[model samples]
Each structure stands twice: as C-alpha cells, then as structure tokens.
Target: MVRNVESSVDDVYEWLLKKGVSQKISQIFRELLAEHGLKQHISDATHRLGHTLDVLITREDSSILKGIPFVADPGICDNNGNRSGDPLAIRTLLRLSKAPRERRTVIFRKIHDINIDNFRKDLDFSSVTYKEASVEKLIIHYNRVLTATIDVHAPLKSKEIVIRPNTPWFTDDLYSAKRDRRKAERLMRRTNLAVHKDIFNQKCMQVTKLIQHCKSQFYINKIQEIGSDSKQLFKLTNNLMGNTNLSVLLEHDSEIDLASKFGEFFIGKIQKIRENLCSLTKSPTREVVLRADIKFDGIPLEAFEPMSIAEVCDIIGDAPTKSCKLDPIPTNVLKQCSESILPIITEIINKSFSEASVPLDFKKAIVRPLIKRQGLDKDEFKNYRPVSNLPFLSKVLEKAVASRLEKYLNDYQLHDNVQSAYRSSHSTETALLRLHHDITS
Candidate 1:
C-alpha cells in the first residue's frame, strides 16, 4: 500500500473523455456542478494501491457536512488483527442545516404604539369625512381611509423571531426565579461561603416549589376551562401522557390539494343533504284557522330608522374588542377612533338599511375547519365543522339590526308569549318555572 498518484478535477474530465463522453458534454457537466456550488473532497488516493477510486461530493456552502470524509486504511479488521483489503471505511459527522438560533419572520403593526389624538385628527381630514351617495362606496371609502391612517401611524413591520418548544406552565415569574437560582449557584461556587450556599439551597427549593405550583395550576385551570367537554379532557390527558395529537394523514400531494379535498368533502355532504330533502315525499295540506274572527293588529316592519351618532358611539363603545383577520382595523383601534368615525359608520348603517343590502365586505367571512372532537376519525371530513368569523364592522352592524328588529317585534307584540329561548330575561330556568306554574294551575 503506497500513495503514488493524485487525482484532480481535470482527471475527472479526462476520465469522462476516456469513457467516450464528448468534450462539450464533459464541459457542460463540469459547469452544471460548479453552478450548483458542488465540491469534490477526495483528491488523494483511497485505494490501498494509490488510485482515487471513490468520490466524495457535497454542497460547497453547506454547514451540514464539514471538512472531508476520513479515509481509513482500505481494509476490514478481522478477529485475529488481520486486515482484509476489499472495502474502504469512510467516516463523517452529520449536522442539521439550521442552528438553534434560527429565526422566523412575522408581519405585524404595533397598534398599541399609535397616538389616539393623531389618529383621530388624521381620520377627521381623511376621504371618509366626505359622504358617498352609495352605501357600498361609503363603506369602501371608510375602510380605505381607516386602513391607511392606521398603517401610517402603526405601519406594518416584520420581525425575525426565534420559535422554540415551550411548556405551558413556564411563566415570566418562573423564568425570573430560575435566573436568580442560577446566579445564586454561581455565587456559591465562586465564594464558597456558607451564606451563599444557604442562599443557593433556598433558591433551589423556591424554584422547585414554583415549578410544581405552576404546573399544577396550569393543569387545574386548563381542566376548568375544558369543563365537561369529554373530548378536550381526553386530549389533555393524552398530551400529558406524551401521546401524539396528530391524526391520520389524508391522501394529497400538496397543501392546496388537501384543502381542495376538504372543500369537496364538505360540499358533497351539503349536496347529499339537499338530495335527501328533495327525495322526501311532499303532501299538500289546508291551513286551519285558530280564530276566524281575529283581526290583523300588527304593523309591518319595512325599513329601519337611521341611528344617531350618539347611539352608534354607544354601541361601538359597548361592543367587545374582538377582531377577525378580515377586519380593516383592530377593534381596540376602531374604538379609539370612534369619535371621528361615528358619523361615517352611522351613515353607512342607515344607508344599508335604506338599500336593504349589506356591504359585500361585511358579507365576506373567514372560515376555519376544525376537528369536531378528539378520538374521532379526523381523516373523515364528516368529523370536521366550519367556523366562520366575520369582521368587526359586520358584527357591529348585526347588533344594530338586531336591536331595531327586537324593538319592532316588541312594539307589534310579534313574539310568542310562551317562548323562553333567545329572548331577553328568559332562559332554561324561566322555561322550567313557566312549566311549573302551568302544571300547578
């Protein structure tokens, strides 16, 4: 075994030519490898006899494989310390492509950083201040103005944030305690003082107790939040037991295809329901009059009155600060600028009522499909339900409509007297009381 010959990139081209490859083809191959940032590591002979028989290739810029693969003596060790000259041993250490500190990008606007006074001033002078004849146009203008003003003040910014596995019980207080414990341990190690040792011991006990307390409280709160939902409770228990939450993977090539399949499944279910309804037998029946001499005393509700700015402001103020991604602005931001935008919103609501139509933006909703419960066949679309989230303005408008409709119903005595559900001051308890009174009477 002796090192006598060295092989280079040129030697590879020569070999390719010896194998009947044309000069042009060899040149193209070399160029392709170079373009892909490939590197050849085995320049020295690997065989026992001095010939470069093996090639080690890797990405030139990748940290996944560093340095060259170690070329052990071309032989296998036998039981009696004998070497068999057949295969060579190649060794390398493999590493992950990304480091632990790898960061991800997140786009968000600092809504809390916005100045309310400046925001109000900007909205007052914005294009939304001018009234549009059509409700749709007015809504579009309002959305544009609000979005632009908020963007100007808050601005959509991107931040590279590192994401790592986290425990639900790990709170800021617990983190602080751990940090103090480590500092105390370091002081004890450096000073070798009895007080420092005692402090470290105390810190260790404090951290241990905090960890147990935090973990127990976390589970307790989670169980309470889950309440009587057996599915959630079982899922939590499984998670605590280190069982995977992943369901059976559906057959699809890509995410888009998977989403399409889900859509098809839900649509097919709806179609099947419609088909069943259509197949049902229909019978024509005569209507029986309960009171032949009864007169029509209720007034017909055709249109709603335009709400005042004060009323719109009150409604907006009382509304919960919940928002959907489809909303033009955050609910809190909208509330902060309500004074400047109240007239525009009030006008839009009145125009919508007059036209008997809602803005198209308000009609659009974001739909999310969630598994109905754990321990169910998630691969089956039947086990999933669609939850739709409407924008903030949509909910506000609906509240206004509901209030007006309720007033109309109350004024005309249109509601059923015995109905207890979905009515103010009436619930299951009231329904039970009514049943008791009827039984006693």
Candidate 2:
C-alpha cells in the first residue's frame, strides 16, 4: 500500500490506535520494521524517492493498481548504486536519399577503373600464380578505396570528439541557469535559508521553461522541414528519441562484456566439440559418383556460367536495402553502380569460379542476442538466443554458390526422391503424403 507522502510514522501509529488495534501489536510492527533496517523516504535536494512516489500516485489510474507497489527510480534504497549511463549523443544522420559525404561507391568505380588499367599493364591474370589471390587483392583494393572516402558519421557520436549534445535549442543560457539552480539548491540545503530556497525555485522554473520553449521550437522546425512525408517524419522521430538500447544484459552493460560472454559460449563450446571429434576413431570415407537421371540443356554440367551485365544489374536492382553489411559501402550503394561495375564484378566472379575459392572475409557474421523469454532475468545469458546477421555481399555470394550447386544437382538428379526437406516442390505436406502412402501399402 502507498502511504500518503504527508503522513509521518507517528500519524500511522495514531491512526492504528484509533482503529482499535492493540498498542503492543502496533509497537511490535514498528520494532520489526526497524530491526530489518527498512526505511520510508522523504524527498530532498539530493534524492527524490518520495517525489517518484508522488508522480506514480498522481499519474497511475486507481483501477489498475494491484499486488505490491512497484517503482522504477526508488532512490537510495541500497548501497549498490544503480546507474544510467552518461547521456549519449545519438547520431541523427537523417537522409538516405543523399550521401552525407562523397559517396564511396563512386570513388570505388573510379579507383577500380584506374586499378584495372594499371593491373593489366603490370599484372597478367595468366601469369598470376593464383587467380584467387588476385581476386582477393582486388576485393582488398575495393575496401581500401571505400576506406579513403570521407567519414559520413555524425562527429558527436564519436567518443573521441567530445562535444556534448548540441541540439539547436539547448543553449548556453539554459546551461548557466541549470548550474545556478544546482548552486542554489546546495546553499538552501546547507543553510536552510528561505531566501536561498526562493532563489533555487526561481532558477528551476526559469531553466524548465526555457528548455521546453527551445525544444518545442526545434521539433516544430524539423516537422516543417520534413513537410507531409509521414515515413521520413517517423524515421526522423525514431532517430531522435528511439529506444536503441539492446534489451540483453551483460555484467557491466558494456559491449566488451557481451563479446567476452559470447566468445566463451560459442568458441569454448566449439573447441570442446573439436577435442571430442579428435578422440573418435577414424571412419572410412567413400567417393560417391553422381549420375544424371534428368538432363537440362540450359544448366551447365562442367563449369559455372558467368553472369552478364544485364543479369547482374537485374539481381542488384532486386537487392534488399537497409540490410546489415560489414563493408563501409553497403549493397544499396553498390546497386546504384551495378551497371558500371558489371565488368569488374564479372571478371572477379569468373576468376573466383576458375580458382574455386572465396576469401574467408565472406564468412563474417554479426551475432546479436535476442531475448527468448520476457520474465527471465536479463543478466542470465542463457535466457537469450543468438542470431547471426550475415553481410549483404556474403549473402548474395552465398546465393550465387547455392544456385550453381542446386542447378548441377537438379540436372544430375543427385538427391534421392525420398528427400523432402531442403528442396523446392517438397515440404512437410509432401513428406506426410509419402509416409501415408507407404504405411498403407
């Protein structure tokens, strides 16, 4: 039950006395509370436990109140201090229609055109020991070109560039007023002077009003600038004040803590599995020959076919944008210049197949933990499941590989008719039908 903010412990005892409760029982209750070291709070300049209670009581609907009282900012309750991180200057890079800096894709196209000429002069593909190595070098060069393009990220977001949140409306005047309020508060608390208290209250009101007016004007301007575009407005709003914090908990609420925990879970388990595999006795392996039961003239039997400029352009045009990518230049950026870079991509793809190897960089994935159950303590790592977000380029390359392999397998009828999963035109329904037929027969 929420005790009234104005009521003291003596008032509670007196109220119980009037209610015909025994004095001995009421005294015992007070004694037990003191023995447990539990405390009721009064609001002060340094802490606001009672203020939080007042807000909750005033804001919450009476109809919804149930069970025990719950409070978010129950201040000075325990010695283990709860901390909200020092405020972060979240990036407000609002537009995707235009690059904030010189576009990396354009620079990459220019550099590759230059590099291909220089490469052709000194380095012949035929003379190159490994075509795979050459292709790898080309990709590395592409990354280098992208790296040289200007940094488009917001400067305040960078920790090294230590500018505080510089919202157009939050000015030096407001900051000075806020500082003065804090000074007045400290003076009033120490001296208990009515004059200092009045000064503090005045400063507080001034800061709050100034902040509200400035912020209201700023947001009004942004909305007007965005006009009637609902999607852009929503995106802008989300970027400005969205809950970007991941729900998962790490020991110190640090990225380093998360990484270390994941490393222990994944890498440690993999190492253990490897040790177990090594301990197992060797099993004889056999080479299974693939025979053609069905033939398709369009599908290549011996070698992978090179995708034409038109084919590459079509594929990239249908590519999903705003997806995750490890590379600085995203697939969306690449799609814009797909036609221009087709020759270079075709060369790389053809060489890649001829060499029959891909760089290990393509295997990289970002693991994000998703909460599996809501009520479980977030600090308990097992309650969450990890999801791997593959780079867009890697996914595209993987699809190309899968397409070639599936084509070859389908042409040769390499998989048995019994196979119902991991194939087109086969599903649980088909598997069930086949099972039913066999069972009856």
Candidate 3:
C-alpha cells in the first residue's frame, strides 16, 4: 500500500525549485501534513481491531457520537475499560518475564480469551434482542457470528508500536529475508574488501529476488481473488499507488478539531426537509387545477408482490464490492452464501418493502471531504466537496426498494420519457435522439 498522501510534504518545500504547480496547491499539501498522524492512528486501530468502525460524528458539537473507544490509541495499561490490557498486567509480567516467543503468544491468546469474558463490548444488530430466528433475526445472527469471529482474530490493540504500512501479505519468512537484506546493505556500506563486496552482493541479490517474487505472488493472488471486477482491481492498484488516502489540514491538527471544523461547516447544511406543503395547499389556481387534471393512462397493473429468492440472489450476485461502504457483514459474503440461506434473505427484503420502513441505521452516512481541484485554497473549507459513504447493507436495501419501485413505475407508466438520465438502459445518446426527434416532429 502507498505510504501516505501527505508523507511526502517535505518534497513540496523543494518544489521551490520548479514554479510549475501553483503555490496554493503546494500550501494545500503542507496543510494536509496533519492528516498523516490521524491516518496512522486510524491504520493502527484497523490493524489491531480487524475491522474499522465509521465514527458517527457531526461537526455540531465536534464530538464522536459513538465508537470513540475504537478510534482512540490504547496507550499504557491504565485499564479504564476499553476492553484493553490485562488488569493483572504487572502480576502477569512478573510471573512470565522469561517466557519464549511461542509461550508468550500462547499466554497472550489466553489473556485475550479472558479479556473477551470480562469486557462488555457493544452489541451490534445480531446479538441485540435476539431470541428466535425470524427473518431479520436470522440475518443479523449470521452476521454476528461472522463479525465476532473476525473481531476475535484481529491483532491485539496496542499503543505507539511503530505503525508500519506493511502489506498484509507479508509472511514471517519474507520479513526475515528483508531483515537479512538490510543487514547485508549496512555491512557492504561499511566494508572495503573484495570478499565482503562479493558475498554482500550475492546475498542482497538473492533477498531482492525473493522479495520481488513474494510481492508479485501476493498481488497476483489478490487480483485473482478480485477476479474481473475492474473497480476492486483499480482500488487495489490505487492503494499501492497512494491515491485514496485523505489529507487532513494542519490547522485542524487533531482529528477531534477536524471533526469540529467539519461539523461547524457541514452540520447546519443538513436542513430537515420541509413538510409536504402541497398536501396542505388549500387552493389551486386555474393553471394548477388544469395541470392536475391532465394525466396519461398507463399499462394496467398486476398486484405488487414480494421479491423471489432467485431475484434476491441475482441482485446480491450483481452487487459490486468496490464501494468503500464497509458493513458488519459484507454483501460479497452474502452472495457467496449457500442457496438454502437465500430464502431467509428474501424474507428480510420482502418484509422491509412490505412495511415501507427502513431503520435509521441504514440512513446514517459518513461524509468524507475530497479536494475538487489543484488550485483550491488550503485554508478554506469551501474548496472541498463532501462524498458520503453508506453501509453496504443500506445499499442492498436501497436496491431492493428501487427494484420494487421501478416495477411499479413501469406498470403505471408514471415515469416520464424526458427523464433519460436516471432511467435504466437510457443514456445521453438517447436523450439527444429524443431531442432531435422532437425538433423534426
């Protein structure tokens, strides 16, 4: 993966040589240097926790509404209840100070198992109010099992351990080879003898070849796993190429301040949509009355019914996993699930549409600010546009709604021909053709 977007900010200073890119762009890079540290904390948390949580924050008060414990660094064992370090840490260390690496690993694993018993983590959807396997209950239960397993296996959270952006694919053997290569490089730098030079060169070359081979194999496996999904392939490439990392402004040094700044600029913008004023319209003028009377009769409707297992399977199967919306349970996993499980999933989708109510959890969105262009002012928040990420489950629910709604619209022909942009299978070319036909007519 790429080191960081702002990791090379010092090089921006050397851009004093070339007057090509504008000073404003360079300043933006400089201001973004603070994001590197924030990103380091985020990365470390992800590594330790197996999965990352989207901190529900609004700039309104600049406080995290949930999951602050997950984001904060797990510094020295004060044991204030973040499901962190052993309460008996000093005692345990005194007992096992001379333990071997293998024994230490075993001991920590036991400690982690014990920690799970004592620490009361928040209940995600699965474990909450679960008694019997109803549609929602079964779905959430399956997700809970998978989620708990993943959380159980995640690296033990720690503080200030050098957060290296080491590739997840790196093995102990490769790491050892890399260490040896570094040693060889250092030795060659210090020595002058021909014997030393030859041995160092051979050893370095072998290590270099092994490293290249390992990296190639790792990426190849990843590509095969992604398998013809161009978007996921592109995301993997971008991680290596360093494109997706967000730059944090130095003015907002800590994430807390950035959260506050972002909230200040954005929270007020979230206006509650006004109530349906049209429903309360006491009087309609002549033009509005005439327009209301003018309606086109559409193809007759069949009774609307629930989606089928086959249809549900198709929708899940076609879902693109490239979307950055992470969820407790991923759609990719859902797609690959056994056919027998499809009916339960279909039941969940059916009841959701039948009731026409979506949970508030589905509606919550995480906003990430993206810089629009090269000359954006570093100091101004307005230069950035917000791109919101939704949970994968929300998108799946959205797709279910759209499918049912589209069928309804098609049956009644309520969709206007002029709306070529959002209509399935319509394009800019179709819009142009329609315009040309109208002109000729």
TM-score winner: 1
The prediction achieving the highest lDDT against the true structure is 1
lDDT of 2 by residue, 269-378 (tens): 67888987766534346333566666655645667776565655565566677556476455654565454455555566556666677756666778877778767787
Question: Cα lDDT of model 2 overall?
Answer: 0.60
For candidate 2, what is the total of clashing residue pairs? 0
Task: Put down candidate 1 lDDT per residue, 188-261, tens digits, no spaces.
Answer: 99999999999999999999999999999999999999999999999999988988746454556797887777
Q: Which ten residues in a row have the lowest lDDT in candidate 1?
A: 1-10
User: All predictions: root-mean-square deviation over Cα?
Assistant: 12.0, 16.2, 20.6
Candidate 1 residue pairs in backbone clash: none
Between candidates 1 and 3, the lDDT winner? 1
Q: After superposition, how far is residue 133 of candidate 1 from its true place, in Å?
A: 2.3
Clashing pairs in 2: none
lDDT (Cα, 0-100) at 136 in candidate 3: 53
lDDT of 3 at 166: 60
- Which candidate do you rate higher for TM-score, 1 or 3? 1
| Model 3 Cα shift for residue 53 (angstroms) | 58
